[model samples]
Every structure is written in structure tokens, then in C-alpha cells.
Target: MAVSRHLLFAILLPMAAVAADFPPPLLIAHATVIDASGAAPLGDADVLLRDGRIVSVGKALVAPPDTQRIEARGRYLIPGLWDMHVHLLRKGRPEAYFPLLIANGVVGFRDMGGDLGFDEIARLRREIADGSRLGPRFIAPGPLLDGPYPTLPSITRVLRNADDAAQAVLDLQRAGADFLKVYNRLPRDAYFALAATARAHHITFAGHVPLAVSAREASQAGQKSIEHLFNVLFACSSQEDALMREKARALDSTDVDERRQLRAHYLQAVLDSYDPARAQALFALFACNATWQTPTLVQRRAYAFPEQAAPDAALLRYVPHDQRWRFDPGQDARLQGRDAARQTLERRYFDMDRGQIALMRKAGVRFLAGSDAPDGEAVPGFSLHDELAELVAAGLTPMEALQSATRNAGDYFGLGDTGVIAPGARADLVLLDADPRADIRNTRRIDAVILDGRLLQRAALQALLDQAAEAAAGP
Candidate 1:
């Protein structure tokens, strides 16, 4: 449970060279401030920033005579967003995605497991700290801790026993991981051991609820956050225990084809046996335990209805050539060779997932906005906006959707001064050309971004986008 020196450095150095990179004391005059604190927007507000922190926020903020000022009249300002779940170094060059994230107003992120080594992650952190890179501040578990037979063995630490589980947790904690990234296919006993070790060390472990463990058990075991809503649907089944047993067998199987068939059958059984009463009870339990959910609905939707994964020309301009194939359903094996009945089942599962999300929200289960970007049709940064829209479509109010990425994210990560715009808060603000409160889609109408007090106005933001596109286009 001991935090590594590197982890401590990452936490302590919020902005190591901000004074040199940013302007003098800066002020934004006459803008609508949507602080994302579940409070009403303050109109005609002025916010002053100095040395990477908000100096003041009010109707009239006094600043030094030489202070740099932005005439933000008619614009809306809110805390910069956080993509609670991301895979920055998963597929493409991680640096190439940084400008895209910043251009879309994502100032911070939690990188889900990727292929990068801890040393590489540390290097990226150093570059960002020294203002040598344009990117989001991030916390990551360099790679996932998966079962002995992992889905992505190349980017995983395979655990075989209780001893392995315990050691994995401690090793990741000491390797500067913000939290342990658990995965599917883990043995039940090993999962419990991992969870116990995490709790003993006062470290957090979160990710997929292992197939051998039920979601209820995962919630009770203190898994901090559930990603991709994995196993949640099955837990809402009236025959949950029966389905879980089948899942356990699937996990233990040596045959890949058998495992795939078993998983498909188990998922169908879950869909068939879903009970509203059971779903409600499970959601209540999650609420009670404060188990956070990061559904990554955009990615789910893409997988569910892959036939509709037509390439988006506008968004595609920013996607790297090698990665653009992910936007085409015809190229995906899962999307191809699906019969009519299979398509119907996929649609049904997706609808139920959205319905369950709505129910969970009403039951007071807190959510974190995440787009499993570059995984599905989800494009980094832009997909986060799609996620907010999807959240709203699933019955969240626009403000609530916005909060999932902002206030809720800050609370989830325990980043005190983040995700809010107030005196003493981090100077990571997004200026929107339209008010997001009126429509969550307005979050995409970003006019400017202020990262660690260094303002990127419209032109600078565009430059970031242009750079990203050029990178995507390759040399």
C-alpha cells in the first residue's frame, strides 16, 4: 500500500513550470460561469487566474495593471473536462492524441490499462510537467492485471494464484500506478485476495468485474469503480447465480471457441432473465456502497450496432489512417457474419443497458463519463462529447451529464480543486461558444481552453486540431 516516490512526485507536481509557460495574471471578463457544482450559472462573471490557480471568480475581479485579459462576453465558461476512462497509449502514438484531447477541452484523464511500460508513462508525465507537451494531466495503471489466460496478454500482468494477486497489487502500487486495473477471467479466490490486499494497503482497485465474481460480490468487496458496465447486466438477472456459474465455467475453459460460445449464451441468458425488481435492488446496493460506474456507452453502442458504424468524414479527418479501419463495421469480424436474430439480440441488449443506466442514475448510483475511445468508433476527445449526449439520451439532465465528466469526476478521484470553477480551483477552464446547460451538445462548441493558466484561444485550439490532423495524415 506504500505510494511510490514517482507517484508522490506525480501528485505533488501539479504545474512544475507554469509561471514560465503561461502569461502574467490573467482575467476573463463578462462570461457565463457554469461551474458544474450543481449550482446555477453565474452570468456576467469575471474570473482571474494566476500561477495555475484561480485567483478569484466574481462579477468584477481586480487584477494587476499588466494582467492579460480575455473579453469572454457572450461565452460560457466551465471547468475543463475529464475523460474518466481512456487508453492513451493503447493503439497509436500517445503524443499524437494529446493535442486532440486538449483541443476538445479535456484537461485531465484517467488512462485505463495500456501497453506502455511504467518508465514510458513516467517520461510522458515529465514532458507534460515541463510544458514540453500539450496534453491532459493523467493517472494510469501502465498495464492491466488480468487472469492467467488474458484477452490481451501483450498488455497484461497475468495472475495465477492468491500469491500472484497480492504481489500484483503491491507491485503496481509501488510502480506508480494510480490504482490497480483488474480484468476479466480472474479466478474468484485470486480476485478476493487482490481486493483484500488493495484494502489492506489503502490503495484502490477498479475495472471489469471478473467473470468468476458477481457484480454484487464486487460491490461488496469494495472495487472502487466498474468499467464498461461489465457483469452489471448479468447481476440484474433473476437467474443471476445460474448465469454466473456458467460465466465461471467459461472463464476456466481452455478452449477459446467454447469460452466464446459460453459467454454468448450467458449474455443471452442474462438478457432473457432480466428482472426490474432485481435490477432495482442491485442498483440500490451500488448506491449504498458508493460503487462508481463508468459505462462508456459510446463504445458499447458502436459494438451493439456496428452496421451503423459508417465512417464519419468530419470526425475521420482527425483519425490516423491506420486506425480509421475501426470506424468501418464491414472490417470488423464481430459486425460481419451476424444473422437477423443475432442483430435483434444485440439491439435488445443495448436498449436494456441504457434502461439500466437510467434506473441506476435514479437510484442514486454515481456515474463517471468515459468514452473507451479508439476502441470502438469512439474518437478521443470528440467521443467524450458523444458520451455526454448518450448520457442525456439515457435520461440524465444536461447538467447531470456535464457533472459526470466534471464535478463527479473530481469527487471520484478526490482531486479537491478540480472539476469546479471557483477561487483556489485549478485554472483548467473551457470556454464554450454556446451554453451547455441549454443543450449538452454545446459542450462541443468550445471557443477556448485554459490549461494550467496557459490560455489556448480559438486560434491556438485550432492549431492543436490542425497538428493532430497532420499527425493523423502522417509525414
Candidate 2:
């Protein structure tokens, strides 16, 4: 299903959408607006939406004679959230999770590498655009490109040399992938070749900094966004050159026991060798290049302390039987047969990860909120809110945390009108019972969600949750 870039664009024109079947003009009156444009919240304002785009926002606005309106006094309005990293195809239950995501106000996302092919994802995208589906708008990397010895073979395409890597960039682009997802184990030559090919083709490449490449090298090569802090901690170590040589071997080895021992050794080494000066320089380089980071602290914490990662009883009901094993601590590979010393070291690594945020922010490095949801203990829609909480705990102001999922996402995607509340912007918004700027956790107190100008009130949102629960419970 290889499509030329021109044909792909023609077919995907619906993606730049105003909902095809939305009702007449809708008015939301007396609501306080948190526009996510770094502006002060507007008090007691009125917002008008027509044809799936915001038509006006002011202190008071009148609507058409036949307009539908929501009296939103005492509520706060904000842009709908985006989970920057997700894997919708891994478990293959998008039918169930789509409702859950919308219920939690996730209007958009970026799918990292997954099992679904590009053609199928494009079909889903079309359905969502035409108002035939109930899910977030997304940009996806159909399958990730990895090294000769591919990791996660089910979702990876192996590139053994520079030629293969370069060709893959062209091939994935023809297949209509939004961007190239580069993974670990890539040889240095292949990684750079992929980057060069992607640049020539006008497609961006993002994801892991391969074992053979430094974060600085990846940034220089124009990797757009780095996910999960892979390679970053090691790159910030004073002993980076020596440690990386050892770390690369650890990852490339086929022997599990040998690999685990090597990983344990380097984990402690990275912790002990962290150099703030080195990190400052690295962060400065990242800022200079405008590279974004999706640290995904929620999943990292789950991996660090699996015993405490279990979801609460309420959330557990949403975990399907086939997927529940992933939530179990016993299934955590990091915890299996590890000694007390390794466990303590892992905790310290997580704390160090949290500490990196403050320094990186100070050095002008920007972030995007991602939960790596349904990976480890990250639950589908709910885990995004958890990621925000983790970001605030890690030193982001509530506004900064909100921007990671809203304004920053729009900037990253180059969609100027998607993540803000203003005239001509997409009518995707969230209404909260409390002001999220006052306390980040108030984001969870959602009163309603408006997607493409069609409002879903509190009862409607609850029905979506109930529908998801029923699907999860079914055979």
C-alpha cells in the first residue's frame, strides 16, 4: 500500500477537518477560558463555535437564533489534551480504548511504532475525520526501523546497512507514515543515513538515540523528539565514552543473563557518574536544536517500582483480561530475580530522572507530556493525567505541565490552530469544574468535552466510560 506523497496528501485532506456532520452554531457562555497561549485566563467569557471551528471568544457573545448553548458559569475551559506518545495497536483494542480516551478529554495523540500497518491507520484516520468514529486525531509511524538484530520484531523493520536505512526512509514515506521512528540497536552509519534520507525527503525522524550514537550526535543529525529519556542519562555522565561502549555491548548481546549483569553494572555506573556540567551542556545543545523530550515519567516510575505500580480498583476494571497480566508486578522483566541492591539502584535512577527536568528546563529544553500509556502500568486515557502530576512533581509549574499536553503539542505538530482557544481554532476543548492553573490535579475534574464542536456533557462522558467498561468485560 505504498502511496506517493502527493497522493497521500490528497487522500488525507480530510484530516484538516471541521466536522462534517456537526450541528448549528454552539455557544458556551460565562466560562473562564485558559487558552494555553501563555495568556492570563479570561473570566466570564463566551465562546462561539460554528462549522467545527471557533467563531468568537469574548466577554459576552450572542449566537444564532437556532444556536445550541451550554450555560458554563463557574466552570473553566481549556484546550483538549494530547498524549504525545501512545501505542494504540499493541493490544489491538482501539474499539474499546477510543471511548476511554475521549472520556478523559484526549482529543489528539501521536502513535509511536505499532503493529498496525499504514493503510489501516489511514482508514481509521479517515473514519475519525468524517465523524464516523469516536477517537483522537493522530499522526502515526506505522512500524519502527531498528538494527540488524531487531528488537520487538513484531513492530520493527530491520536495517542492516546504510543503504537499507536510507531506502527505508523513502519506503516509509511512500507508505504514508507521518515520521520515521528510529529505535535502539541501529549502527551509527545506518542511523545517520536514515536521518539524511529523511531530511532530503522532507520527513522528520524521531524516537530513541541508538546505542551507537550520542544524544548530541542525534540532535546534530536533526532527530525531532527523543522518547523516554533513552541514552540521555548515559550521555550526561562524565564517564559517557567508556560507559557507552559497555552499554552498547550489553544491549546487543543475545545472552539474557549476561545482558542483565551488564545492565546492572552500567546502571550503577551511570548513577555514580552523572555530571551536572556535562548535562548542562547537553541540555543547551538540545535547546539550541529545538529538540523535544517526551520523558514519559509515568511508565519509568512503574518500571522502577513495579510493586507499587498497580492501578486502583476502579481503574483495574477497565483492564481487559488479556491485558491484565501486563499490570501484574510478577510480569515485570526489570523486577525478575533482581537483588536488593539492584532494586535500590533502580529507585535512585528514577529519582535522578525526575531531577533532570529542572536542569533541562533551566537550560531551555522544552518537554511534551507522554505517558507511554498501556505500556507498563500506564493505563490508556487515565495515565496522561498521571503524567501531568508527575511533571508537576518533577518541577514544572502547573501552566508548563498543561502546555506540554496542549500548546507545546500544537507547536510540535506545526498545527497553529489546533491546541488553543481562539477564533479560527479547531473546536476541541475541555470544561472543568475547577481551574487547572490553580492546581494541576484539577485537570482530572472534567465536567464536559467538546470535540470538533460537538459537546459531550458530563452524563455523555460517563456513558463513554461505561461503554468502555462493558467492552472490557465482554468475551
Candidate 3:
């Protein structure tokens, strides 16, 4: 079957002046094309791009005189990757952050949530579209719309009641948000109010499954996507109903320590009582409601095995000095003077995360690969590659993992213009030094990155990284 007719947000990723320039066709000749649309690899094929769209993909297609040829006799060609769930800036400048994406062959990304003001977010996106910034195509929620009690009050828009919830949705959408991001503490009634209002405005509402609501109810209420697999894991556990009851009571507690103890106890209960049959039922509902899951298993694993995360000197160059703690294993609370009990819980959650992916696959529920980076103290550009590898480790085939980053995300967010290499798709392509199908890690071997029909040659791509490193080195 062909790709869906999902119309991308037009202004969401408007190409630069390269679109009007009608740059000469970029001929990637003699490459093995793994389109990521489940089509068999086209051995020794030529993929042509012109005017910001893929014009053709075939064997030995005629190379016009006006074309710039990339001799790819043994290389692999695929759609540029998308990081579906990311927090773009938890530490450094957006300037220092963007080039790392292109340098790593990530041409598109969804800013799951950020602290940037609405206009600032709009400005950054506009810069990318106008070719003024060397960043990936950005689509983000204006700011987080959280419950009255929020963890990050600076970036959060507090919704104290159902009326506040409804107004918050309208206000954020009007302020040029790509979607409404409902946060964890939102009451069930307020969460529904926001969802209903988002539906009325024809906007996408996504984020956490509120504390009082089950994943099934969120899916039923038109929650477009759920990030971090937040409450879904427990929602599928055998103790789901009981856990929900407990959570409702926990919210009323003024004692912070008491709440934490109760949370830890009940979470342990969830892992012990996990039921595959119940999981299958939740998966069925998720599939039925067309709600997508962005499983940021990387975050979960980082907490579970913080000792394994040694900072890389090379990758840290792109990470600002103050922001480097994000990559520090010592910073994770789960690892700081760990007890055997907490370790077991972390390990169980990590295993359950993989189990959830396998079950989601069996139930035919779609997934979007998200790094949940920056939030995980992840080094932005490199963390996405790690996320892909983690997806494969969890149970996805290389192509399946690639799809979660590409086609599945495109389908999820209606960024149909990108995430595929085909006639009329966006001309964002990545040429790898080796076939990623053979090993998903080969995706990291980017030989060249094509963005908006403009080629960034290997040397040019290296320069982007170098410049980012220099900027990040700033005091």
C-alpha cells in the first residue's frame, strides 16, 4: 500500500529559499535504497531530488547535466530521521544545539515540550524554515499545560480547574502551538475538558496520561499521543484499577514523603501484578482509538543503569559545560546511594518497558521512537542514535525501529511530507556509509545529509559539528 494522504502542517516545516531556487536535481546514484516504507531495498538504484521533493527512485535513472551527482555505489540511502519526542534545550543555546542534529543526519524532530515562550518558539521554527538556522524542522507545543501543582512552574501553564483547562487549550493553540501538551497532575475532569476543547479547535492534544485517568480513557478522549509511556505501563498492569484508586487518594496527601513511599509501594505492586492478557486489551483499545505511544525507554534505562552511562568526551563537546550533568550518572536519583529495593523496581520497569513494546507490536499498535533526551540528561544529537539502538534491543527489527523514527512518526503527527523517500515526499535524505538494515547502528555512519533538497556534503557536515563544538565551549 502507498503512504497515507496525511497532510503535513504546511507552515510547520516550510522549506527555505531552496524551494524557489529549484536547485539542480540531486542524483544519488548506485545506492541501496531502504525507503523505510517496508518496500524491499532497491539495489544499485538512483534517487533524485529537486525543489525540495523526491522526484524519483529507480535504477540508473538518467542524470541530467544540471544535476549534482553523489557517487553512492556501495552506500545506503534512506529518509532523514525524525526524533519524535525530545526536549530541545534543557541546557545549551538553540544555536549550539541545532547543527548537531544535521551533523548526525536528523532532519526533523518534534519538541515534545520546552520552556521557550510561544513567540520565541515560533521565531526559532521560522528561522529554520527561512534557512537562517541550521536546525531540524521543528514542531512544538507552545509550552507545557500542567496541573495546578507542577514540577516546572517556569515553563508550565497551570490549569487549576476544568474552566482553566479549556481556556488553556484555546490560549495555547491560538499562541501558535503545534499541539497542546497536557501534563501529569491534571485532574481527570480537567484533562477531559482540555481534550474536548482541543477537539473543538481541531488541534492535537498530547502528553501525559493524567494521574486520575487511565490510558484507555485518555485514548478514548482523543489524546493524540502519550509521551514516556507515563501511566500506560501501569494502566495495562493487573493492578490497574487498584492503582488508580490509590493514586486518587495519594493526590490528597499533603505529606511529600508519605506520597513518595506510597508511590514506590504501589509501583512495586504494579510490576508484580503485570498481566499480559490485560496488556493485550489495553493495546487493542490504543489501536482502536488510533492513539500513538512515544516510549522513551532511554530515560527509563538511564535511571535503571546509571552506572553504565559514562560521559563521552567527543559527544560532550556539543553539550554545554553546565548542561553536561545531564549525561552524569551520578545525577540520577535512582542511583545516588541506591538500595536493593529501588534497584529492583528500576530493573522491573526497564524490563516491562521492553515487554510493553513487544506486546504493542503483537497487538498491531503503532509506536513512535522518542529519545526523551535532554530530559534524561541525554546529549541531544547522539542520544537519538542510542534510542534507535535501544528500540532494536527492546524487540523491534532494524527496519521496525527505523519506522518508529520515520514513517510511524510521520503518520502519527501528519508530517506526511517527510519521513519517507518516495516521489513527492520531502527531499530530506540521509546517505549512510553502510546499510542500516544489516545493523541499525550503521545509521550513525552518515556519509552525507540532504535537507530541503540542499546537500550538506561530508566535509560541510563535519564543519557544522566543529562549529557547534566551538560555540558550546563558550563561557
Candidate 4:
């Protein structure tokens, strides 16, 4: 079961070998292109793709004699969307999620946390890159590092102290992890040590801001990104209250009311201390500091509303019947006597967290759209579109929300040639039925998804989704 580096390369070698043959160019014509670069959408444009790269894009582009042409009339083309945060191995088979993501126009994803073997993930990345697999590009950490009893069970290692944290980073770097993911339970010293070690190893540090460390400290310490919107909530809190809260004991179900009161007090203090001058200074620091945030509002909304705990129909199709009962823990925990109170606390946390996201956006903090999809209430590819919709609800314009998934993510991850439709950019683009520039919801009307110039039509996309659902339902 251990996927080794050699095995991974073996799995990918066929794709690279196939790509060695020069294929005929693919020409897509008569499409409306939304390049995600804030450029005006081009009407009746033609995109020329050759050997898995976009060679030209313009109106009335002439195709070579041997080029295979795809007529895309009535479709709107844009760069493929990126789910900036996801956990590929949460549902047991990380590979199953790839086609589902591609089906819904998710051409790239950052694995915020997962238990996937690095070799397997790297293999999948290579296979997709070389056109062996029908999937999106993947960026992932090897495993999660946390103190004892981390919330997510997929965490492969635990850090007990600063030394453990430092060693964990080096181990992950050796394992070829794309980044170091820190969890919420680590102590202040361990968190700082991990950050320092990640920097020394030149590995990107990302994940939850530990309760013991202030968000500002984590940002200043070179943590590349923060997940779950918790860091922003901590950042918006009054510095004095944040310091006090950091020393408080871990929260428990019995102390739910007390936690809410403390959180409210901290939030009010933050709002009261909201000096525009101070906020501007803080925003400047974040802008230059390379810190990113994934709001993951789709998951937030799902956790917030227990009254509506039923799964979305599209999502339910992919979740196994045996696992369906896992969706509503409160209902399952009716015999435990703690369900009601826990549900109430969850709802409260959701509302406050969303409010914190609004505040962070207003303060000019950088954000990456992530669904945390196919995890609990999130529904993989569909959840990302919902993230964009929720972001629009939080006051970002359609373009801004789209940017969060496109150019913003590409720029943040140093993928300069992607997230745009230019002369030399990669051909990872989606063709929608409607103009998403006019409305964010139009993003869902996907007509086709173009990955490295190979187009997957809507019917093909549906087939991929069906295949994933079948795989998830299998014995």
C-alpha cells in the first residue's frame, strides 16, 4: 500500500511517453473568452492549442491544415477554477475525487490537509500533467502535524514539543511534501519552531493557526497560508483579549456558553478597536507578508445550520449510504444528551466565523476560495462554486470572487503562466454557458472544461461524475 517514488514514476511514465509523440494541434473557435486577468471578454475568439500548450488566441485565428478544430460557439471560455483548499484522502480514495473535481471545472486544488502518500499524490500530479489521467493538478502536504488528539483523524504524526515540531517539518520535507500543515493543537513554541523549520527547509507552511499563537505572530513568522477562517477571526480580535484567550484551557462541551461569551467579548473589543489607521497598517503587512486565507464558507454554512442538516442531492449521490448517517452527528448523538447543546454551539461558531470573514475582507486581507470539499458537508467540486457564491454574498463582486479562484490563486502559488488565457499561458480553461462576469452564479453553467487543450464536454463531465459516484458506492 505504500506508494514509492519509483512506483509513482512508473505509473506516470506511459503518459510522458505518449506525450513524446507530437499530436496535431487543437483549435477551439467562436468562443467568448473570460481570461480571468481582468481583461475584457473577447467575442467570437479562437484559441489555438498545440502539444498541450496554448499557442495563440485571437479573433479569426487561422488553424493549421492538420489542426483538429473544436467548434465552441455559444460557450464562454475562462481559466479553470482552483479550489485553494481541499483534503484529497478524507473519503479514503484520493484518486476518486480528481474526476469529480474536473467534472465541475476545478482544474487545480491545494490539498490543505490529507493522509495521501506523497508518492501517490506526486504520481497523480504527473499523470494529470502528462494527460494520462482525467484530473486536476494537485498541490499537497505529506501529512498534518499536530499536538495530541488533533481534530482530523487523517493526521499521520503528532508533535509534542518544539523539537518534535522541528523534526516533523524536516521529515515532511524529506518525504517531498509540497508544504507543512500545522494543526490547531500545537503549543506556541512548537508552532514557532515548525514555522522556522519550514522556512529553513524552503517548504511552504500552511494550516490552522494554533489557539496558542496569535494570527499576527503566525503571519509574521512566515506561515504561507491559514485555513478555516479561524486565523482571521483571531486576527480581528483585540490584541489584549487574544493574548488572554491564548492562555485559556482547551474548550469543552460543558463550557460552551462560557466560550461563546468570551468570543463575543473578544469580537466586540475588536470592532471597538477598529482604527482605520491601524487596519491599513495591518493590511499592508499581510499584503507583503505572503500569508493567504481560505474562507471555505460552503462548509461554514453547512455547519452553521443544523435545522437544514440534510445533504444537497448532488452531494448525497456520491456519499455512500452507510456514510449518510455520518452527516448529522446531532441526530446520531440523540442518545448522548449533549447533541442539542453541541449543535447550538456549532451554529453560534458558524455565524461568528462568517462575520469575521467579512471583517477580514473589508480590512484588505488576501483570500483564497476553498470548499474543503467532499469532507463532511462539503460536496467536492460543487462546494467550490458555492464558496464563490457565498463570497459574493459577503460583498465581493462577481469578478472579485472569480479572481479568488483564478488569477489570485495562481499568483499566490507562483503559477504565473496559468489562471489566464494569454499567448503563452497553459490551456487549463473552462467554457461556461453564461457570462460569469455579469453574475457569479453563471460559473456553474459550465459548457466545457479544457485541460491542456483537451476538451471535456458537459456529457463527458457528467460521465466522470457518474464514475466517481459509482466508485464511492462500491463495495
- Number of the top-ranking candidate, with TM-score as the measure: 2
User: What tens digits encode model 3's per-residue C-alpha lDDT throughout 1-475?
Assistant: 1211111443334664335655688998999988898889989999988888898888878867899998999999888888888888433568677888888888878787777776676677667767677778767776687777785778788888899989887777666677778887787778888888878777887888878789889999989888888888788777888887787667667876667677678778788888878888899988888888888877777777777665568778887777777688776543565577877777886787677888887778788878876767566677788989988888888999999887876787655666898898888889999888889999999999998888998899999999899888985
**What does candidate 3 score on TM?**
0.94
RMSD to the native, candidate 1? 2.2
* Candidate 1 per-residue lDDT over residues 391-423, each given as its tens digit: 999989999999999998778867678899988
lDDT of 1: 0.86
Q: What ranges in model 3 sit over 4 Å off?
A: 1-13, 16-18, 89-91, 245-260
Candidate 4 on 1-475: residue-level lDDT in tens? 1233432343234335456654688888999987877767888999998866789989899888999887889889888899988877554555466777888898878787765677666666666555657676666776777777666656557788999999887777777776678877777888889888877766677888777777778789988777876655445544644534632442432475555555445545554554445445555666668577787887767655645645667677776565566566455432233356555665565676676555566667778899887654676788888899988887777888898999887777665666888887777789888888788999999888877667788889989988889876876
Write model 2 residue lDDT over 1-475, tens digit each, in one string.
1333633452235445534567788999999999998789999999999987899999879788989999999999999999998887654568777888999999888888788877688777777777777788777887888897788898999998899999998888887788889999888999999999988887888898898899999999999999998889998999888889998888778888988899889989999999989999999999999999999999999888888798987997887778888888898765788788878888998999779999899999999999987887778899999999999999999999999999998788766777899998888899999988989999999999998888999899999999888878876
**All predictions: root-mean-square deviation over Cα?**
2.2, 2.7, 2.7, 4.7
Provide the TM-score for each candidate, comma-separated. Answer: 0.95, 0.96, 0.94, 0.86
C-alpha positional error of residue 406 in candidate 4 after TM-score superposition, expressed in Å: 1.4
lDDT accuracy of residue 154 in candidate 2? 87
Native-to-model Cα distance after best TM-score fit, residue 188 in candidate 2, in Å: 0.7
Of candidate 2, the 10-residue stretch with the lowest lDDT total is 1-10
Segments of candidate 2 deviating more than 4 angstroms: 1-20
Candidate lDDT values, in order: 0.86, 0.86, 0.79, 0.72
What total of clashing residue pairs does each candidate reach? 0, 0, 1, 1
Distance from true location, Cα of 249 in model 3, Å: 6.2
Residue 301 shift from truth in candidate 3, angstroms? 0.5
